[model samples]
Target: MRPTSEAELSAVISDATGPLNLRGGGTRLMGPFAGNVLETSGLAGISLYEPGALTMVAYAGTPLAQIEAALKSENQRLAFEPPDLRDVLGTSGVSTIGGVAASNASGPRRISVGACRDFMLGVRFVDGAGAVVKNGGRVMKNVTGYDLVKLMSGAHGTLGVLSEVSLKVLPDVEMQLCLRIEGLDATQSVEAMSAALGSPFEVTGAARGVDGSVVLRIEGFEVSVRYRATQLQSVLARFGAIDLIDDQERCANIWRDIRDARAFASGDGDLWRISVKPSDAPHVLETIGRNKATLDWGGGLIWCEVAKGLDIRAKMRVAGHATLMRASNETFAKLGRFHPEAAPLAKISANLRARFDPRGLLNPGLMGAAI
Candidate 1:
């Protein structure tokens, strides 16, 4: 169902057939799923902007490019640095800000700037009850009841269908630089990556790719970026470093994959995204070292493409949590890669789902077990 207006959106949600699968652009939803899809491409436009307050609100269906362009006009940007999913999903375009916030798709900057949820000021959505509810507000500070606005940031439409949203914006950096340390093994790479993050100097992006390399990004004024880059180079000298001058196109290309899990999209093997403590990376990778893997998020995230017949669940048990990035339909259905039920907080998740979508009609089992 296409909803061009709020009234149309409300009408779509009120459908009694099944729980609605709220989608913006329907990019990620192309994967496996079973539900009545509610396409929200109609709800588009920037409703309000307060430059003095550094806040903006846009319809859920608005393209991210439009929002970024509007924010750029004021020399501001979405600080969380949401990545374009096209790299991993092999889709044609970037993810919408609505989908980015809904999926909580933060990038390497998340270590410093914070996730999409943190920048969310408020939201306007239609819950399963078909009632329009508003949470938070356009202002920076709101200490009202439960922070439903923030809660919905990563709900992936399981709770409600977002009609519009309010977000905080940050001024763009004057300059940016990415420092690379090539030819380092995973162990050395992790060490250098950790040292950079531990230092007083702010290092924005950190990742070790499949090519046995480590890289970090520093952004700020020219003087600060130069100084921090030099300091980071000095610290990582033991790992044999190489300086990557920040070129707009090159920078965009390198980070596009890092942000969207593109580096691991080489073959048709099953793909897994593993999140773990940075220190435990070596052990986990050694355990699953046989599989093709690349490190991101400073070794905290492991992209492992496993051979067929391997037990992906066992791999997730070893690591903390794993998401099925790319896999066959048989693998997806049989392996059950997105296991929300196995998570420790599953019970509380069920309760929360009931509160937001009591009817269990929104994207049931999409993210696993309705929770």
Candidate 2:
């Protein structure tokens, strides 16, 4: 349906049911078609701007690239640096502002800066009832009622259909550097990475691979980055980094791949994203050591390639959370794509679904009914 206004959009949604799929460019929503889809691409444009206050309100369907480009003119950027899913999905869909908030796709800088949810100021969306609603505001200090703005973040369009989003942008850093610390096993590397995070010196990116490779990044003024690079190098010497890469081109590409999980983009096998505590990384990885794997986010994220017949959910159950990053259609359908949670939370998700989508609509099982 072509919606020229918010009312038309609400009318389109009101009449749809039985798995309402919320789509922007239908990018990540690919694979299989299911249920009624509500496309927000028609409801697109920048509504308001507060450059002095470092804020902008944009329609949900507005492309993230557009927002970034506008922010670049002012040398400003999204603090969380949300990743573009196209790299991981192997599709050229322009990740929009709504999609970023919906998926909460934060990057390496998340450790120091914040998550996408952390920087979101407000949102205006149409609920399952097709009623237009607004939450939060363009300012930071408005903490009136329940934070529906943040609750909508990472909901993946399950809670509501986002029409517009308010965001916080920061002035771009002058310089960025990535320091490679090599030759430390997963255990030692995690300790070193954790130590760096705990220090007064701020390390923006911290990651370790299963192959005993660790990379740290610092972004700020040239002097600050240089000083932090040297200090971090000295701090991580116990792990024995043979070299440091401070090059601009190399640093940009490396972190880009890291944020997008390009290292494990081999689409032939099952790819899983396991999020575990830094301390439990070694133990959990060892538990699934037989599978092909790579560690990222300083052992916080484990990308494992498991056999088609293996119980991926069983393996992930040992960790705090996990997701089937990639898999065949049959594999996804038979084994399920999401990790299982406790029964109580399952009930809560059911209630939430009923509340947000009483007709059992809205990307049914896209994130699984249990979430």
Clashes in predicted model 1 = 1
**Which residue runs of candidate 2 sit more than 4 Å off their true CA positions?**
1-4, 29-33, 368-371
lDDT string, candidate 1, 1-371, tens digits: 77888887777777656756667875662346667767777788999988778999999888999999998999998888887766465556444667877888788888878889999989989887778989999876774998888788878887788888999899898988888778887788789889989987898888987777787888889899888888777777777747767786676667777887777655667778778888878777887867777777778888888786466657544547777767777777676656445456777777887887787888777665754
Model 2, residue pairs in steric clash:
20-362, 207-298
Model 2 has a clash total of 2
Best by lDDT: 1
Query: Which ten contiguous residues of candidate 2 have the minimum total lDDT?
Result: 25-34
Candidate 1: misplaced stretches above 4 Å? 29-31, 244-248, 316-319, 341-344
For 1-371, candidate 2 gives per-residue lDDT tens digits of: 54656888788778774566677765562335477667777777888877899999999888888899899998999978887656555566567788888888788888888899999999988887788889999888976798988888987877788888999889998888887777676688789889888877888888765456788888899998888888877777777743677788898888887787776665556777788888888787777867766666666777777776566667544557877766667766666666666788878777877787676566667655523
Q: State TM-scores per candidate.
A: 0.92, 0.93
